[model samples]
Target: MSGHSKWHNIQAKKGKVDAKRGKIFTKIGKEIVVAVKNGGPSEDTNAKLRDVVAKAKAANMPNDNIQRAIKKAAGELNSVNYETIVYEGYGPEGTAVIVECLTDNKNRTAGNVRYAFSKQGGNMGSTGCVGFMFQSKGEIVIEKTDSTDEDELMMLALDTGAEDFAAEEEVFVVTTAPEDFGKVREALSESGIEFLEAGVKMIPDTYTEIDEETAVKFQKMLDVLEDDEDVQEVYHNAEFPEGWEG
Candidate 1:
């Protein structure tokens, strides 16, 4: 809310994800399967599954696909197994990056992730190499419309267990403790509030500003990671220059 705008980062990621909508759907479907396997297939009984379902819907994943994913994970259809893995490293200019992956073959995922990092002038490190620089939090973004009232929305979010609320240039961001995310999300949804994006994310404690050269390399690394079938999400602390489109 202070240093770099999270909204801008979200928009940039959305742009990248939009270009490969099918890949995004596949990534989300993997998440759904993992969630169902961890908990049950029932959203009502599985909070993790419910959260992943909401994320899938936000990404415009078809309901049919969502149901199929659940059924498959629950063994009604063909069964599959995946392991969640998190890799942390330093991107160009020592910018911290965290990549969340889901893979049945850890060896292949690790090799691919390491290759992406090295190819783009980054170095993959051990699990906690850059993990300490981030905190897991729930972030919900709502696009500001003509009827949006900053004051009312702030109050509502706060009352619904949000830890912080910030109004950006074109959207309102609601932050909450990780454990309170579902409660706040459900409360706002029940009030007819729509979200542009909602999920638990690894938010950097501070952002690292990068020069144009470094930004280019950093983005290339991100692109490589995001394109990997095993990679689900990539989080970073790099702040690109003004009007940078990478």
Candidate 2:
């Protein structure tokens, strides 16, 4: 943990993983199903479902697939029920990791996740072991080109009781109190600023740093977590050096 890069350049060059579309679709569908089952099918009434729909649209999921997911989630069609779970662990160089997932097979996911950590030079820790190292908050990313100025956004978000705000390289990161997330998101929308992404995420209290070699290994661990259809997000308390910008 000599240095840290909280923001990794995730835009590295690579061929399209379009072949993973089916895997992505299956993961997204499970998410929609769980969201609908927990909160109901109507997007207007179910905030969770609304967010899931937004995510599906962002990912370019087919309308038919979306409709079918909602149907299955509402039990209008036969499908296995899923539950939301979070896994906390330590990665290479003691980087804290939090993984969010939706799965019907808890045991299977736990085994898979643990195996990935072990093979990747990390170890899975007890639940809440690393959770305390992060805070759960709603995050929305808006483009820098938007006419919305930081001062204007700060005032508006503060008026709505937002927790924190930061203007990053290409986007603004707006953090909101968990309960006021939807309100903040809507207010931003009404202001005509387009958001790139919105969701609840775990932001680390502090970031640990590893050498370039270890950082690449940690990145591989992240790949393993994200590849799981059951896994939704993998939050780490590791940061890369700005110089290590990929």
Q: Considering every candidate listed, which one attains the maximal lDDT?
A: 1
Summed over model 1, clashes come to 0
Task: Report model 2's TM-score to 2 decimal places.
Answer: 0.85
Which 10 consecutive positions of candidate 2 have the poorest summed lDDT? 1-10
lDDT of 1 by residue, 1-246 (tens): 332336675355566667888998899888887887778889999999988887887777889999988887788324567888999998888999999999989999999999999998889999899999999999888889999888888899999999899887778889999999999998988888888778999989988989899888888888888889999999998878877888
Candidate 1 Cα errors over 4 Å, as ranges = 1-5, 10-15, 76-78
lDDT of the candidates, in the order given: 0.85, 0.74
TM per candidate comes to 0.94, 0.85
Which candidate has the highest TM-score of all?
1
- Would you give me the overall lDDT of model 1? 0.85
Write down the worst ten-residue block by lDDT for model 1: 1-10
Candidate 1, 198: how far from true, in Å?
1.2
Residue pair clashes in candidate 2: 4-239, 5-239, 5-240
